[model samples]
Target: MNEITERDLLDFALLTDFESFLKHSMLTLNPGMPFLPNWHIRAIAYQLERVRRGEINRLIINMPPRHLKSITVSVAFPAFVLGHDPRQRIFSISYGSELSLKHARDFRSIVESPWYARAFSQMRLSRSLDDEATTTLKGFRKATSVGGVLTGLGGNMIILDDPQKPVDAQSKVRRDSLNQWFSNTLVSRLDNKETGAIIVVTQRVHMDDLSGHLMGSSDQWEVLSLPAIAEVDEQVPIGDDEFHTRRAGTALHPEHESLETLRGLQKDLGSYDFGAQYQQAPIPEGGATVLRNWLCWYDRPPERTTKTKVLLSIDAASKDGPQNSYSAFSAWQVQDGHYYLLNMERGRYNFPQLRDKALALAQRYEPTLIVIEDASAGIALAQELRSMGRHRVKAVPVERDKETRLFIQTSKFEAGHVHFPKDAPFIPDLLAELLAFPHGKHDDQVDSMSQALAHKFSGYTLDNLH
Candidate 1:
């Protein structure tokens, strides 16, 4: 095609589609760089258009980093929205002042470009700056970092992009404070709550990070979580009624991040970090001792016999409170050199209540042996249970830490020697705790599980296990 015809076609596309506008803005900012197109960017643009059209008000996007998230949502989307409706006000937020300002400047440049004028002939900027822009109409674009002041100010679209840094996510105090700010300060700064839109764009940082906190709260939020690698067959919605059939183990954006590069990052960051940043799941799959996919799930174990060595492992907490850990126990049936988890329970209980529950469970399951970590509530509970000669109890001293114990038994779990009940009520908790080992909020379940494996297979004879 000729240059004028091509230019006319491009300008037409820029006015018609947000995805085309994103590509134009990307090229405008990065002069000589090639714009490698990906389906994820189109998906994000569709969501943003939905927001502009007032179809979606509250949206949460969790995806891997370096996928043009800021360019598309933070910078390009706002300018595109303003091109369509200059009366719309926008606010872009980030974890730091520098990133927020950078996004604002990029948005400003796109709006000020010569081609932008051709696409939106009616739109004109009356006042503009590196971090703020105002149009001829009563609309503006502003930037602010997390915890920045927005008193007496509101926007039609408030965009939160990476609200918490990776280091900040590790600190509960920081995460909680950021969450509180979003709930109290940010959410309140909506020009019109009925029609206003709020979009959060960030990678998964922790279990209780902004995404988790918002999702856990009573407030409703629509989540679009795109992991680096698909764990199972999925029909991910792109835009309109279209869906991308992402098969298992396929990369989300292979042009940007190949499978080889992702695996290298996983190896370097380890499962815990990779799980948060890349997988969009706070727990690792295979990097941790237990792989969720490798999990050997069984409906039930063979009929109990005298030869079946049943062991009960307990990791008890002294008190019952919101901050306190839950007292947990797992009953395993070791048969034919393989371990099958039969019964599991986790609850917050006082000492007397804890003792009664353990005794009752012991009586019910009639385990061959019961093991408890001699720490905190476990020591006293072990003494009480030991005094009751009805159950054979063994209090294993906490010579090593909980992670160390779980680490030592990693091979047995990965070797497919351990099995869990498929349809148990507590299966979700059990899998979540096991996969999140060494990093999750509560390690009580893992502690009890590792204690059981340690006591039963302490001999280190792989032959018996294999």
Candidate 2:
């Protein structure tokens, strides 16, 4: 046997630690580019190590595009994981065949290189026609796209790199189909359900995209959300008891993107897209439809006078289940053609509970007119109230979608006609749903607000904010 040398010792080091392997193999896949040390890289490597040891079964990594996510996650990771455990089968997937093949090629290149052999000297390869590299140990790394299958096989570790193209994720039908594939087909491909690990590295496409769906799964996912710019302070753990302090307003990887550059991208991509893709928040600050600049704050609405038109708009929950949407109603007082929100209440309730809650609140606020969406429980509530000789209750049938209704009232919000209480408990939830709009999960508040605006001001005209 050959005596151990300095090079041999170095190879052992590379084989043992994820950071060592990742740092050294940076040049193995991409020959020319120098590795600029980023905190996110270390953080990701640490998390992957945890995954390998079965510490984390589910990992969702959300970062901005072109931020070394593809290189580190798809290319280097498969090579590194298989190096330590050559028997570990890896199924790598991407949004398209081209991307999946590209990752397969990169992983194959790294595993075939002299550096990889030095570290994993026992691991052997096959010069195969398929987009795969098999080890002598009977394990392989195979690449496939979103709908592509592995055919009656499963992997120890599955990596989904950009599961959906940004545009495709916007379509509800496409998104739902992808979600079904993930929840049904892909999930069933785990070699060992209890011990297998799933790593999903993607940019946030929509609020209901693959990442969002996985987040709601029973198996909890440790989300590493490194936005292009930090929205809040966070301590991203890189190693045991070691952390990278990410300050608010600071860039995630300054070497790759400066804060000013990210701002420029926001302008280029628009707030909604930039917010989802880069910011990872999926909604912009200062609101999307109802701009915060136009939001008028109030301690209280002007005392109810004969001129004030009290409108109670209830957007009932579609059903009475814990998982279903919350039945929400917002009370607004219109005075001098301006709508000031008085109060809002929302909760998961059946018909009787919802009716009682509405009537109790209505007793206190004493609304002159009430508008409810003409669907689900809203229809029944409107009928019951009308049967009680409450002719003020109007069940408005909606021909347009939720987004269209909100968009129609965009002018009213921008014209500074809508006002929200400064310190109301429900204000945060209301504004969050309003700003998140069509993308957010719960649009009950948005429905209520829009319904009130359409019914009360159908005959009125206001000057646009010019």
Off by over 4 Å in 1: 1-4, 284-433, 437-466
lDDT of 2 by residue, 1-466 (tens): 9999999888888877776787777787667988888889899989888898889899999989988888788888888877777788988999999988887877777777887887787777754435788887888888899989667988888999999999998789999999999888888899888889899999998877898888866558999988887654678899989998887668888877887787777766755787789877676445666776777888878887778788889999867765577788888899898899988888779999989888887787888777788888888998887777643677788889888898999888888888888767566446656777675556877888889888754443222100
TM-score of 2: 0.65
Q: Which ten residues in a row have the lowest lDDT in candidate 2?
A: 457-466
User: How well does candidate 1 score on lDDT at residue 43?
Assistant: 76
Alpha-carbon lDDT, every model: 0.83, 0.81
| Model 1 C-alpha lDDT per residue in residues 200-296, reported as the tens digit of each score | 9999988889998888884668788888976545777788899877776688889889987887777668557877888777874343666666678
Question: Against the hidden true structure, what lDDT does model 2 obtain?
Answer: 0.81
